[model samples]
Target: PVVSDFKILKNAGVQEKESFHPLRWFSLEQNYPNPFNPTTTIRFKLPNRERVWLAVYNSLGEQIRTLTLNTLNGGTHTIVWDGTNDIGKRVQSGLFFFRLQTKEGALQRKMVLLR
Candidate 1:
């Protein structure tokens, strides 16, 4: 469902300069409960507004899930994985990698799931 109404604004003869500072890009944090079961949380920080993609890969280097977010504002955001694959089926206990991709770059972290 559409949540917000689109708005149109007239140009105010001003263009905001994109910051080249280190803080302008996005960042990813390690998943909590390093060794998780059923579920886990992943936190990230987007210092500047932009689109992003979060994905999960198995130990065999095959993608298991892909999460895409539309334009998001700059700041911290959190997402959760229920230890399931893209098809909504539970995955086996093993090592997995979760990666956050953005126009700026990509970040990945390792996690373990216990049955």
Candidate 2:
């Protein structure tokens, strides 16, 4: 059975984060420390509740990792990558792409991992 968990309690009663620091539009920020070693932070902003999927790919276009996350709220969110693949194997230094997809569209950004 596929299980979906929602943290309604925490999100409940909380106003949209964008209202406080509103986003001009939906966006995906470039990973910080672009040429990162073993780890990096990826940030994005949403305008509404939606199912968000994020994945990492190698320069050859093969999916290497999936950053597991639940349904997201309309606001900014941070995701961390540890330079590992789905099987927990450490990847070597090179160029990679992080793809964030929603019903609206998919945003893909390039990043580098330096070992």
Candidate 3:
């Protein structure tokens, strides 16, 4: 390797962030307003582009609503659940679990919906 003379450029450009930090693993964050009445937001992160499956299930582990079933880019994503079922019917108030699935694996979290 040969070292060539180089000069530092002053204020050439600056990065928006000090450093770029990408998601290292797939994960699901807890839904905001855990005990929600009408709607709640679900957030997840993907290290790479992949097919995603987000759904809500009852305490019995029965899937009631399919929030998202598509391919998403590698980044943080969010979806809103309006406390409804697959058929657009409002569900009863109780403790429910939401699951996020991708090729990497699966992650689930609990949320409650109140009528």
TM-scores of all predicted structures: 0.77, 0.77, 0.82
Q: What's model 3's overall lDDT?
A: 0.94
Locate the minimum summed-lDDT window of 10 residues in model 1: 1-10
The sequence of per-residue lDDT tens digits that candidate 1 reaches over residues 37-93 is 889999999988888989999999999987555778788888889998889999999
* lDDT of candidate model 1 versus the reference: 0.88
lDDT of 2 by residue, 1-115 (tens): 3345544466557466554655545689999989998789999998988888899999999999989556889998998899999999999989999999887888999999988
lDDT of 1 at 35: 96
Residue 77 accuracy (lDDT) in model 3: 96
TM-score of predicted structure 2: 0.77
Higher-scoring candidate on lDDT, 2 or 3 = 3
Ranking by lDDT: 3, 1, 2
TM-score of 1: 0.77
Q: How many backbone collisions does model 3 have?
A: 0
Cα error, residue 74 of model 3, in Å, equals 0.8
The C-alpha RMSD of each candidate to the native structure, in angstroms, is: 16.2, 16.9, 6.7
Could you tell me the lDDT of residue 27 within candidate 1?
85
Model 3 poorest ten-residue lDDT run: 1-10
Query: Candidate 1: deviation at residue 71, Å?
Result: 2.3
